[model samples]
Target: MDQLETMTCSRCGGSGHFSYNQIHGTRCYGCNGTGKKYTKRGAAAAKFLSDLRSIPAEQFKVGDLILYQGISHSKFVRITSVEVSRAKDQGCYSGDGEYQQVKIQCEGGYGAYYRPGNLVRKGCGAEMKSEQLRQALAFQATLTKNGTPRKRAT
Candidate 1:
């Protein structure tokens, strides 16, 4: 991994804190309150490293967790097979009857068929603020060329 360059947090002016008014101040979300932020190249390298571990969506199997894109605080859904016996037991497949009916459970425990596009694997390095994506990137900066992490100089 290339070195992640640091910059003074513009939102907080290197203070690690931002204030909307004299009475209100909060830690800078931009830099995670470290007063330093990553350069564009650094961020891209981190993202590229993450993108390397992802596999094609079509390869997902039973019990795999998927994160649906284009939604906020999206919960991970595990794939489970649901058998449909009759026409009334059918799931939502928004296509013509020319193809065989496929059945699968979806959000809210309803039966639905998923196209499996834009779904990210749970282990993928795609950023999730709640999941410490940046923290992992920061840790990556401390690793040696051999892929082992080195201690800070203190």
Candidate 2:
């Protein structure tokens, strides 16, 4: 994934405030008072789909743990079956318009359908790697003893 460039607020010049009507403004609406903005267009969903497509359908197997994030919810489920077929009709957003679909049986016998790429193989180190990255980012946001932000992990 490419890192998004940080842009300074043009109006505030990196300051969170600007003079308006001869009064100090509370925040810069342009950057939401952060004084920095992401320069790239937010295409996270597209990136995720691309990453998922890179994994072949043959890689999935029954009894394998997988992560599925739907429009309303997310879950780690056990794969009950894998079917490779063309999509008959558009029903819901299952990550892509691809024909391949995987039938997953979650806890309590609840069944759901999804694209194979929408499911991330659990215990394949992918989940752990993302979790570690999240923790590292959170840790970096914490204040240090000197009241300064901690340096981000390399």
lDDT tens digits by residue: candidate 1, 47-144: 54455444445455666555544334555566665333224323454445333333454455634543444234444334553245555566656665
Best by lDDT, which number?
A: 2
RMSD of each: 10.3, 11.8
Model 1 TM-score on a 0 to 1 scale: 0.42
Backbone clash pairs for candidate 1 read: none
Q: What 10-residue stretch in candidate 2 is worst by lDDT?
A: 40-49
- Which residue pairs overlap in candidate 2's backbone? none
The 10-residue segment of model 1 with minimum total lDDT is 82-91
Clash totals in order: 0, 0
Model 2, position 122, has a per-residue lDDT of 52
Score candidate 2 by TM-score against the native. 0.35
lDDT assessment of candidate 1: 0.54
- lDDT by residue for model 2 over 1-154, one digit each (tens)? 2332356878789987765543436677777688986433322322333353334444667776566666778666677776665665476545555466655565446456656655344534577656544544343335344334557689
